[model samples]
Target: MVTGLTLNLFDFQEKAVMQLLDLTTDSRCKQTIVVKSPTGSGKTIILIGFVDEYLNKVNSNTAIVWLCPGKGDLEEQSRQKMMKVAPHRTTQNLFDALRNGFPSESTTFINWELVTKKGNTAIKDSERKNLYDRIAEAHRSGMDFIVIIDEEHSNNTAKAKDIIDHFSAKNIIRVSATAVENKRYEFYEIDELDVIDEGLITKALYVNEGIEDNVEITDDYEYLLDLADAKRKAIAARYQEVLPEGKVIRPLALIQFPNGQPETIRAVERKLESMGYTYDNGMVSIWMSEDKRDLPENLTENDAQPVFLLMKQAISTGWDCPRAKILVKLREGMSEQFEIQTIGRIRRMPEAKHYDDDLLDFCSVYTFDEKYKAGLLATMDKAYETRRLFLKPKCKTFTLEKEYRDLDFDGLGEREVLNRIYDALVEKYHLTSDKQRNRMILAGNGYVIGDEILGQALHGVFVRTDMVAEATSYYGTRKRVDTHKHGMQLLHSTDAIKTAIGLSTGKVKTILERLFRKGGNPKKKLLALNTAEFYAFVINNEHLLRDEFRKITSGMSQQLGLTLEPKKGVFHIPEQDFFKYDPGVKEEIEYLSNAYQEYTSGYATSLVRSISEQLFEQYCESRDDIEWVYKNGDTGQQYFSIVYLDALRHQWLFYADYIVMKKDGTVWVIETKGGESKGKDKNIDPQIENKFNAFKSYAAKHGLHWGFVRDKDNRLYINNTEFAIDMADDHWKPISLVF
Candidate 1:
């Protein structure tokens, strides 16, 4: 029963198509399907889903054509790549239909310029070029073209409608990973929670999203990616297979902003050339628009299609590309339309019954630091049809604090309360930081910046409000309830949020930070650390987490006869106290706990001391250091609760699950957060992260060794490092977070 299905951990396209199929209930109405996914979620695959549906059967051999905004070598190459990425089973089935002359079943990807550009055949070698005329004539031929507008939207409707006229397609399929709908075409949403359960796609979907006022660059990208070994392998495999060896590809990336971008492709091209990579021999060519370089009047496919890249302010819509494998975002985020245009270039082919393994097979993307400016990822999620980036922080999104208070607790469905509260606090309220984000309120219906505005808004919401007070002092804070029970409360209340949508927060320190720049300083050139130390930091903090687990469930702890204690930040778990539980439960928990013990932390019933020692041994590899300690938990007796886990601090002192000798004078100092509940009224318990940051500051003030990091938008980048963005996608956040 739900009309729209929620997204799943996997099988994105399958979920979408199934959602679309549900529309069969309204068989009487001819509906234009509008799908909203990120730039790489595979909308093309969904478009192909209709190649032949047995339930709502639409039969025809001549109803398919593709459209796009450009006619360049890259565009054509993109088309070829798509054909190869389609799922094998579906492609085989579609291939059989294509043999029958069915437009949907038939396969063909051509350049719009090839069909739209007209030349005077009347004269042997026309003195003048009628390239535009040739293209028109081609369209007038009325061939079997089932129109699949790859980048269909208000901006490219003219071209799309024209193609629609020519094909008289039995079925019109518009596939855009980033779709901006002029009209809310019939929507087909998926069951997000059951994405993996359905088993329609592979490896589940992953996503990471947020809207940083002005994004910064950082080294977090490399670190986080390292953990996702399987994903990285898949990406490497796909890249290796597509780009031919000795192709001089160097695996580069590019980003394009709608406007307001400082650097142009030409500028980058010059830089690349200066970098000694300008010797193009057919394989390395850039595409240009309106400025046609048609092989000097005589060119052969084998003779290198001029081996040149094309530069266009904007690519045409309804374009087709099969070889658009790896899209790189080198540009900044300016407007949703422009962002969509860039991502649209590579999302042309669908994985219907026609081209298996080749349809929507785009595996990975490379993005420069700057593409995240102005909350690009979040904005695009609202427009696109094939991708998703969780618009919230991972930990917060998974936390279910508010439900504990409301009687209905209904246990807060996994995706509902947690996703709602966290996504809003992090994305809309900007609660992760101490500063309030500056929203440059874009004007007009197109959401373009620097345009004259009748009026403007921020975060796409709010009428008349500003910074609001939170916690210790007045700063823009997220929704909070002054409750004593929940450790995850905010200083700001839902009531406060309701009273002042836009004006209240203007008075907080968050607003002041946004209004005034702090005294700046530059500090670079730091010592390099490896991955082992990082794991050590996490392992050492294990006790804090277990203790918090204890605090939140003391009753259950007592019932289970479980008592926990921390030695050197490592918790001890008892064994005899464990096996006393239900046989199945004991086995499962033990299995998971033992695996953790073999590596890091563990939790047991009565044998807390022994279990803790064993887990510590596992983490330390039988070393004397207690999980590579900072302050001995056994000595202090005085300790703060673990409320927050500052991701960056641990990153700085990256001691791995492995070991190393304390190099005479080369020990890294990293800060950590006490893992206590944020508490009732302070929805955001930033104290933990703040302490870590403070620790870094102390180290900096004393000329010591330490750094800081805060996890936002699933991944993090540093400041002063922004890039022009073609597009940003969080399509893989969900899958990764789950595993």
Candidate 2:
């Protein structure tokens, strides 16, 4: 049994675990299942869940061998994590497992080095009898063995293959972000976009665009180190701005050196000293082959954590730290090719959610080698279906039209609104200051006045129910009726009245009898009061009611979900696009393609796209005839690439873009074109002509308007003709022209 720890697996994590278990247990399922989950997707927790679920189904004890890819630290990390999930089960090395005769219900985490040594020569004869012989004997004795290979890509070598072949296990599971292709294993990939959308990791990778030019003429190592320092400072400042109260986060910059040579290490030390990032000053820590310095302890409680981690390739895999957000690589002796494992170190959000600032919401990589940078981009293009390796603007700014202004609602007076709100509340809740009646009403409607007041009301009600149930226990069929009648009569009794309202017996009795008439159902009346509606009305009118409403709703306002909607009349248009172009956003556009490559202004074309969207939205709001407006990507069903006959009598598929719907039953298909040359060219391109002809045919058949929008020069060409309309100055002109 697993205990003493709470596991909060996200939706994706839970799904991955169930899928893995299904693959492992099916009678006809493959012996090996590959789980290709992205970095920081909690692969360790998924492993634990798999073990737990597997154990529950089997009648006998099963042995699990977790093969990790590194030496002592990786093994230790696996053991600690497994212990948290299943403390009662044994967690040891191969030697211990073999000595114990492959103990049932035990997990042994062995370093790949232990089994992958050359010629199987690493194990001595005496130890081989205990380790290898014991495992082989256990297999022959019908004990089930499950082997899980972590970082399978890095460990999928000849020696590793030998180790797995020797096991001859019942099942094998390989887990990694980047899986090696094998025909024998069943492949399952977790959606990377799903992980990003869940806010489990950072959104995009940001790279320096000018690094190529900088690397050609400058001392590459020194220039790249300076850039790393700048990024570190910028990230630290942003972190401080959004740091939650009572939380300490020391943003870390991970600098990866090629190898742990003495001169290289000394050079990095001198650079750190020059930058005021010395160990004694408490800003730098080193992790290398020869020396390992412990990271600052109590990192969550104190701000003494090192700001910079200088190390070689050792920390690439199996190192988990959320605070490492910046990765700097000085490719001295390292290969020019990019590997995904290196970037995985800095991908996790320290708090599992991005900060409000855009700068802090992304992980950055600074490298001076142009060849290496290009290699990284190529790797990213292949690994992620959507291109995420790109240079992002440091800041985005939007231009606003003078006509875009706030709506006026001052004509509707506060007193008039307050009176309507009060009436609505009274109709729903039966406005009353009486303590006992309000308590009953609040209870029936799921609202609490106060814990003290609610406790007293509950105790009084329980006592009355107990008395009624006891008195009517003999009247089997009439029990419910008898209880209601007795409970109501008890409310009018002298002791009940005194306990409830501290009033005189006669006065309290008179009030109770008046409130509950002879033919009126007390329960039915309480049930009709709608607390949610009443609370909403009170909250919306709080500005008018001021202190009076605050006193009435005091502690329960927040619980009722009655947050006042922003004043509807005063509309404030955001100065920027809601879907801002962050390097972290998953959507991709091919900027290097011919259509976009000619526009060398760098983000100017993207800015034009943003402006086009804004103009459309503004045009929609200003016109009363416009019913609905939708961007091309808003709905998957909005556009149809349909086959149609062109003017040349050839069949073609029209690629539709944006859609505009008007009040008088008319739909317009708007295709936006970018680039000044495209807009200015007299002769339309064949591709554009084909699409135009198809659009015209479809619109004529369906009775819709087909138009073209040149975003570069803000011109509109309507009715599927070469004749253009100059509406560049006023985007609203389209409403009049199209209609």
Candidate 3:
């Protein structure tokens, strides 16, 4: 019945649920278990699955108390998800449960603030009596209780901890993305990489390059706003490009102000209005104290009208909006530190796919305070469990090569091959003697064919050689012919071929003999042959063979279908590890020295490193020899990394910048350097030289060309060649000159 639950859970989620259940059920395990899962990791679904499984398996009379932060719409959302999983069970809120006693099969969702408040405002005398009475009744009735704390980090205050301790539940399961450690509980940390690898969230974060080490707010407020606007426009453009036809999605931006003061709110609002953002026009929605706009229950839900949401720390926790791709923080002071909950608001991908564009693949944040930026980066590093820009390579490159050799076809033409096949079939079917036929008949009736009977029947047959070799290799068997005999006996014993032919083995054997005889034609040897004749005459009929063999030997020929053809003797080369080098590489290389003019192509670009790299990209576009030039960070561009060992034997992964493919099927792996260059050294930096060597080695192994280009003073260096070739002066050269 637990398997009947309709929640679509990822592997990690299911594992988390199972772990909680195991700890709860085992008497030796700890009573309190903490599950640490990141935001957007579907913690609610896991909880639902766990609760449903526990109730259905352990005790139907068990009660669950789910505690969430604040009195917001999250309680309702949690209740709805729980009901979907266990419709037959009852779900109620704490306020409702205060009036009605706890039901036998029910879950109660309570706000943490309700019980954590001080004095009479906490639980009224009547409410306290109701809760205690329900607890007493449940204990008397031999019912179990479970308390689940959601976002446990937020409610770690002394009052909250006291409220959790007040509940006399059998088990406590705490869940949070950023869990604070406590000595009273056992902790389980879910790998953040698992979530990112599963494509449940984005892999990296991208911020504006203009943010400096120390920023002045008064001087850069307008510029910060403009940068935020540009980021929003870029996100919107990307959404338009990748969204399905006829479907529209308006990306939202969250602007977190410093505080909720009226003066500050009004000032920010006036500035936004001048920038064409007004609540009257539906361009902006406010969630501050002064202007509490009636927003949708879930802002991430489709059809929400706000393009910009202005707030001051209200929707940071217990809120999810996948369309929120941009964040603009107007920092007033150092009071606001970057927290994991703040980053989680925009970490989720709306459709769970990055659309292969850097703009869409990353979440951007724009802030004016330098200290706030540093704190945010540090918090992200801790939350994601990553060091500074720890890159995991996502692409691999392979090339195709050819090898020439003489193929041995056994010196046989088509007709001769058919003759050899016929001979092999005759020996395989035991048509050489009557004793062999009797042995096959006995084996078909479930009698084991011993070694002597097998050796006599399969003495001259090589038809089963390949199968015997493969079976012996897989099973580590030395008696190869024993495998063959067992195969033949199993095949003949099944009713598959007999049922299809609707004839007895004696008659089928007679037909097979006439069909496989030396240069024999079925029409001449017997009545005119029909379509079904080959169904039984073919010794290697895969369907009949597999069905028959499976009855005796399990898991044999399960993947092989009904058509089993004889193995040919041709020496054909397989595609694996075959790399092809271009034969016309000399004519395809072009040198441009005098005709270098920057050309702009109407292609969307992002994360450009320098002006020279941009100009190099333009020059690559203008050349006729270049089939396609992929700039780094472009959508659908190939990205790859190579691992090289340093002198100390430490492994380092280096990513290539550009991949250029020529029309004649040649590829160049290029790394562009753009800074003030050391003039004509002809000696690349040792580290860079090591990477170049690694790249060249990988390219040669994969049959791809490799190059290192220096875009300084409008000159290019192919590999380590000493020629200072200009893109403006055009000429042809051999790619081998650099190699």
Would you list the C-alpha lDDT of every candidate in the order shown?
0.30, 0.53, 0.54
lDDT of 1 at 390: 18
lDDT of 3 by residue, 589-677 (tens): 32221111111232212221344455556567566776555444322212245654332222344566666667776867677654234
Steric overlap count per candidate = 171, 1, 16
For model 3, what is the alpha-carbon lDDT of residue 328?
73
**lDDT (10s digit) by residue, model 1, range 172-275:** 55544344343225544433223312322222111111222333222222222222223433544554566457442122122232332333444444544544
lDDT value, residue 244 of candidate 2: 76
Task: Give the TM-score comparing model 2 with the true structure, all chains together.
Answer: 0.48
Instruction: Tell me, by lDDT, which candidate is best.
Output: 3
lDDT of predicted model 3: 0.54
Worst 10 residues of 3 by lDDT: 454-463
Estimate the overall C-alpha local distance difference test score of candidate 1.
Answer: 0.30
Candidate 2: regions farther than 4 A off: 1-7, 118-122, 209-217, 293-304, 333-335, 370-739
Per-prediction TM-score: 0.30, 0.48, 0.48
